[model samples]
Target: MSSEQLAIRIEGLSKHFSVYHSPLERLKHVVFPGRTKGFNDFRALNNVSLSVKRGETCAIVGQNGSGKSTLLQILCGTLRATEGTIEVNGRIAALLELGAGFNADFTGRENVYMNGAVLGLTRAQIDERFADIEAFAEIGDFMDQPVKTYSSGMYVRLAFSVAIHVDPQILIVDEALAVGDSRFQAKCLNRIKAMKAEGVTILFVSHDVGAVRTLCERALWLDKGNVRMLGDAFSVTAQYNQFLFEADNEAVPTSAPKQIEESIPQENSAEPPDAQQAMKLHRPINHWGSHVGSIIEAGIFNQQGERSSVYTAGEPLTVRIRFEPPDHADRNTMSVAFSMKDLRGTDLIVSTTWDQNPTGFAAGNGPLVAEFRLPNHLNAGDYLLAVALEDRSGVLPQYYEYIEGAHYFSSLTEKKQYGTFLAQVSQSVHA
Candidate 1:
């Protein structure tokens, strides 16, 4: 059913768990008249109400202990809610937490068949799609080995492969999808979308905002066992990001900070141009992501896409930055900039997020491209293209560094020294 039609209805759902004490407390409850009725209680689900129509895909998102998992469990009937009611119509295949239904002792092939049966698939249906399942898993010969030996990634792939092959009308995926590599994650996302297209009801859950934005039409954000926001992905994600940034930047000390320094020395007697062309260059290849950190590949290009080693007193040049992130991050942003400097570092042309194209990027993937284009002309001798990326969110990077000279090209193009930038080069020469 689509969002327009009701597939499943949740009514005032709530689940609570009681903490248990020592054996003495357990005995006291059984015996005396004055049994103290007190123990720590946790309400995992609280007054959550929602409806899903047939052929609809919905997502439940929240931070740890925000009751998202509890809600999913209650919907699947694996765990009964303490308060509300859940109604399920057609058959459902759920991929919850890792190895939820499989026996560790069983081989991957065995668990696939066993889990398939649990989804009401007969031997024939599973056999028909067995090869498809195997290929989807990508686990290779390890399928014959007991699952206890499988890595977390291998387990998730196998489990997901079985869950999708059963052809259930409703699919519930918890955070289990995050266990696979990028390719497998994309594969699973596509299959879920396909199921939605075929009119199956799907529920997906993840803390990743990027994945949520790309996969779901709507989102439900839960905080402290309550729905914090329910709306479009972009709006909700922006709200969450704002909250995160505020928390992280609260204590950025003003004392002894890593200052941004501009050093450009100048005023030397004119000398003859070098016999060899004054140029700067570096070839960027597999130098994208590193365990330690990154460097930005910034360059100046003409309209025709040819790069010059040097520019005249004023000439046309556009700057492009190629960024690569480290292996992991909570949140990150990359900033590329250009400043007019002599041999010493002086900030003649400095612009950042506040001025031009202000953008942010997340880490955990491969190369990310950030570009900045400027209009033609500049009075330039030796200017440096400073390319740098910072989390700006104040999160310290585990493996982050600078690539000293990302790329350097001169703007020896002709111009009169009027404005600090090339914008006035033509007017200066004419005057």
Candidate 2:
């Protein structure tokens, strides 16, 4: 890509810090150049190179101490690189730390002006955006209070609000949103989505693999201060998750299942099944297991036993799953599980047959079917279904097949719903 198409670029980037044991050792090393060798070199990042295109959203993912923060610090100019060249071609707004640029003694209002000024905004520009920033923060009367008295959530709220309202060309965030409440986090994510639509370049660090897959088009995985993988978000996150599962000694699928072309049969229906819905059931975003068994077909059905993806609140819904069993496996030691998650990947409900039946049940060797029936209490929104099969015979439960994004559905409600799921309640007046 041309230089004009790139927002940030780095070549041979590296950062190293000198570790000193004590103050006396540091003083000794400074005073005696040749005799004292009291410090060791710790490399935080080594020969890292990446380029983020203009208007592209990219994510940085890894465990702690993996140089994620170090790289972000360098990109934001909070820390200098030990070696390499860097180029950033945009007006940058970064939320790298909590209250990073705020003065504890100053009120939130004053800090807003300071942060705006640091971002190359004029006093008039800050004035123009102050109302929107204050409204987004939702700190109410606390906006005029000293930041030192503010809670961690309040601090992050105000900081994130200011960062977004500044109209930055390139936005950088480093796990700052994790401190906010669920509602506020959802609000921030929506705003980020809006920003991405407006062609803003975004570089964020998040451990939430679901968020990475949903928000970013590409991902970079850092491991031990080196670039482990950098590619499409889905593929990179899949590999990363597999790596973690293996590191924990968990059972992961050894091989991909044979392609099954059969569609989920709709029972007692006059119309044929939808091809798109049928395709999604077999194409899970992330699939893993021991290959001992696999879900061949799955779908959501209505009361009439018709395959449907849309349902109304308080209606009967059933999740049907069919799987091929491993040869000679004892049916008494098997379990089936499924989870319902919202678009942001929050688990609204999780159920497993093993929870009720510890010993499992007896079944035949043919394809096994499991059906989960429940009232549709989920609030109005789109959702994804994940399914898993496990072997309980071992000391620890070993998953035979785990499929994420196995199916998609939506729930509609006429009553006002406040959260992920609706609750049954009755009101009584006593006066």
Candidate 3:
């Protein structure tokens, strides 16, 4: 059989949870098995079926409570499936949680053997791989100390290093790959790549669609315990993201959300998907903010209307904002503002263009752009350009975007620090 030949098969899989009352209900269960605690039961996984072939990298994705972790736990045998069947033909190594299976009281070396043997490695096999695992973990002298004494970073290092070197035929990895530092994450990702090269089948689960897009060939998306999609990683991720927005009301803008699993279509269904063949980075998705008055579209450009990919510090970056009024405004007043913020949505810029400079709008819809030139003496980082047209002026900015990490640029050269939005300055040398 080819590497793509079936390594694992799933059919009619599902799981459910009790509604909002699981905690009280669990207590009741211990006291009274016959009487249920809550009026409604939450169905976590509904009829879901999927397949994975040998040497394939498959990812599971969804928002919280979307049954992603539930499915992975079932596959890892930590949780029993409420229904359906899963079949696999391979020796397996699983990383279901961060720092799982290690006794905090035990040393790293002891936990390594315990974890290795749980994967069915013989003592000799564990010994042979032990040195490599230790070096990869890079915990140094801490390996001899109890795990509880280790930092969270150290815990992740030891846990991840032990799991990867077991040489299993199939690797089931949850989000544990994200626990360590960026450099360690790069290292672990490289190892996953090496495993893929060596024909190891992998089933990965993560909320990080970027990592899933970068690592996996195919993907499965679950929503409220039912299988929403099983297709190319990008396509399924997009659908999963849509459900995430629907599930969370606070997940505003709908186009983008925090830790969003944004996606485009995959170029191929049959071959293992590569990130280059996965999706276009630029998205055509339009956005709407909380607005009594309306601002429909937002776009980025230069003054010439031609789009340029690269912008230098202290140069000019222009953004065009489009809007219209449903009815004639009594005041007919609005504000268009731009802010530079990090990915976390923290306010880096408390300033707006309209407050300082003036732009006028007539009754109906028209194309209007507020422009700001890049100042040279700024930090290097990514930023979002936010513009809005509110019903009222200076008081309350109603129609707000917080456009969710829209425009991003980097410093061509980093002289001192890791930051965006360089400080605006003027010179008056000790005269």
Provide the lowest-lDDT 10-residue window in model 3.
259-268
lDDT of 2 by residue, 246-342 (tens): 6665543365465543432222222212223323443454556676236787777899998777899999888888887665557798998888876
Model 2, global lDDT: 0.82
With a 3 Å backbone cut-off (N, CA, C), the pairs that clash in candidate 2 are: 252-289, 253-289
Clash tally, candidates in order: 27, 2, 12
Report the lDDT of model 2 for residue 400: 69
lDDT of 3 by residue, 14-127 (tens): 776555466777778767876865647667788989889888999988777778778877877778887899887788887767656799999999999988888899999999
Better of 1 and 3 by TM-score: 3
TM-score of 2: 0.71
After aligning candidate 1 to the native by TM-score, how far in Å is the CA of 369 from where it should be? 22
Instruction: Using lDDT, give the best candidate's number.
Output: 2
How many residue-pair clashes does candidate 3 contain? 12
> So what's the TM-score on candidate 1?
0.59
Better of 1 and 2 by lDDT: 2
Candidate with better TM-score, 1 vs 2: 2
Consecutive 10-residue window with the lowest summed lDDT within model 1: 283-292
Q: Model 2, which residues run further than 4 Å from truth?
A: 33-35, 250-287, 290-334, 338-359, 362-387, 391-398, 403-431
